[model samples]
Target: MIELDNVSKTYGSTRALDSIDLTILPLRTTVLLGPSGCGKSTLIRLIIGLIKPDEGSVYVEGELLTPNNIFALRKRMGYVIQDGALFPHLTARENVSLIAKHIGWNRDRIQNRIVELCGLTKFPVDALNRYPAQISGGQRQRVSLMRALMLDPDILLLDEPLGALDPLIRFELQTDLKEIFKTLGKTVLMVTHDKGEAGFFEDTIVLLRDGCIIQQGTLSDLVKKPADPFVTRFINAQRSPLESIQNKADSKVF
Candidate 1:
């Protein structure tokens, strides 16, 4: 239920997004996948009102996002940036309840919401007192998700949510995140650079390069019917270490 019409953003000499038009459909996961400097995060910032576009407009739920309505509209969505961005000085429970407290939620209401989110995100109740540094990377990510979902927003925006975790932890979070998405059935707009991760979570993948969309479709569509040569190369370039070892083994065989 988000629409970007001819959106453009520039920073001095560089253009982060150029005349981009995209629509993030409701009740499905739409992922922005691309290499570094491809404007994925910029797109998210534009929609979240963190940064305004130089040209064009951003609409959420059929209303234009203006300065006056930005804060109120923002409350309709939950955002989780990379690295969790948790407050180091606060405990996990405090961190998750920060926004709710700021919005004047009563103690009982806040406590109930936090408890419900803990179960939804699979975060342990015993670890609520722990600080970010005291927990594992996966637990930290879970805390971040709990905080994001505390408000029960209509849309969820995750910017490279698992980028900092180890492979095993990342895989675990991926599975949990996918299931959470299905359970919540909210509009999801996630940004990621990993093709495999995008393919795993994306109902529609939007690949970008040089501040423009290169292709937008399913993983199978991108693989079998590439819109450009770059798409083919981009899809094939992310081979695993096992594939690399297999290549070396084949070269030495008869």
Candidate 2:
């Protein structure tokens, strides 16, 4: 369980995050959804200990999450940022094996891990031998994901992992990722501006606005009872039933 108690952050006069409290459930996907600059990235940064809160505390599994403890905690957490942050010079296999080598794993062990990750993410065996410049965007993203999962961290944080892909490829990866999560049962926290993406992939949705949580609940809960007009519009815009209604309204009557 990840807990944030009255977390707040400020940069000079501008407040990036207000006094926010949240408890993330384990072994499930929880999505943070909102428009850009609404503090979703800020929340993710704080969770990963990239930045510290000006006030309050963060805890993982009953232990206080401080800079001193963050290094230890990171070993048990995986973070995937937007875009495939791969090394252009390194081949896919080398990229995936990099982390294992850092932790003093032997050559045989690293090779085994690369093989396992390649199988898990469905990357072509030959593709592993090629550099990032040689693969498609989707493949690069998959390699990034495999690298992130190299250690099998309990907590996985994804920031717009599919945001850079084309619609069809994005949908394919989204489905693949969902299935992987179901099989692994890891705790996942993802930030996305796409409402449909959130609804399709997450078990819980957290809506944010102006550095605050506007609402949070299951998709069914929010769909049946939106917290306010913004949420209603957001849901309506992405949900299929609402799209069908919009299509009907725009249909030609001859």
Candidate 3:
């Protein structure tokens, strides 16, 4: 549903993205996996029209994403960033309903949508009146997600949505998120550096390095036949301690 054609972005001397050519298919989850400073976040910003590319074009459902059309185009996509990026003063319900209210959704519609999202994200109905400071990290992210989905956008873009949570909470949210994605069937593009997280959401994984896409495919393709040594290293670098020890023992036994 989204396409980037020869897209490139730079910041003075630093290249944030280098001639990126990517196509995000409809109703599928695509994870952008890479180390820090590798341009994953940059790509997300580009797709969301937060920033313009220096070279080439970005298309959403075949329409070119330009400054003039960005405001309207953005209404068709939902975005969730790290720690939910919630307004500190707004209650969870207010945060979630902000966009809907701005677009003139009635009170009944907003409340109904909030109730639906609370169930979908497993957020407590009672906590709707609580401020961001009053809620847990996981709940904050859920609030952020609800806010994003309030408009019922066709596409969802999440940037490290679970990055700030505890492992257990992260795991729990991951499972819920996978189910939500499947249930909604919206085109999803997520940014994460964790290899296991990428594999868990394994519809397609795009590995980036130094602002360029090094490889794009399933986890098995990356593990079995890496395009470059960096791809193997990147995957192996994030292996769990137990997995690392097991790999060593298996190698010695063989």
The candidate that wins on TM-score is: 1
TM-score ranking from best to worst? 1, 3, 2
User: Who is ahead in TM-score, 1 or 2?
Assistant: 1
Residue-wise C-alpha lDDT for candidate 1, range 8-117, written one tens digit per residue: 99999889999999999999999999999989999999999999999999999999999999999998899998899999999999999998999999999999998898
Q: Pick the candidate with the highest lDDT.
A: 3
Candidate 2 lDDT tens digits, 125-233: 7789899999999999999989889988999999999999999999999999998899889999998999888889878999988888888998787788888888887
Deviation (Å) of 11 in candidate 1: 1.1
TM-score of 3: 0.96
TM-score of candidate 1 against the unseen true structure: 0.98
**What Cα-based lDDT does every candidate model obtain?**
0.94, 0.88, 0.95
Q: Give the least accurate 10-residue stretch of model 1, judged by summed lDDT.
A: 113-122
TM-score-best of 1 and 3: 1
In model 1, the runs with Cα more than 4 Å from the true position are none
Query: After superposing candidate 2, which stretches have Cα over 4 Å from the reference?
Result: 238-254
Q: Which stretches of candidate 3 lie over 4 Å from their true place?
A: 244-254
Q: Count the backbone clashes (under 3 Å) in each candidate.
A: 0, 0, 0
Q: What is the lDDT of candidate 3?
A: 0.95
Question: Is 1 or 3 the stronger prediction by lDDT?
Answer: 3
> TM-score per candidate, in order?
0.98, 0.93, 0.96
Question: lDDT of candidate 2?
Answer: 0.88
Per-residue accuracy of model 3 over 77-188 as CA lDDT, tens digit each? 9999987889999999999998889989999999998999999999999999999999999999999999899899999999999999999999999999999999999999
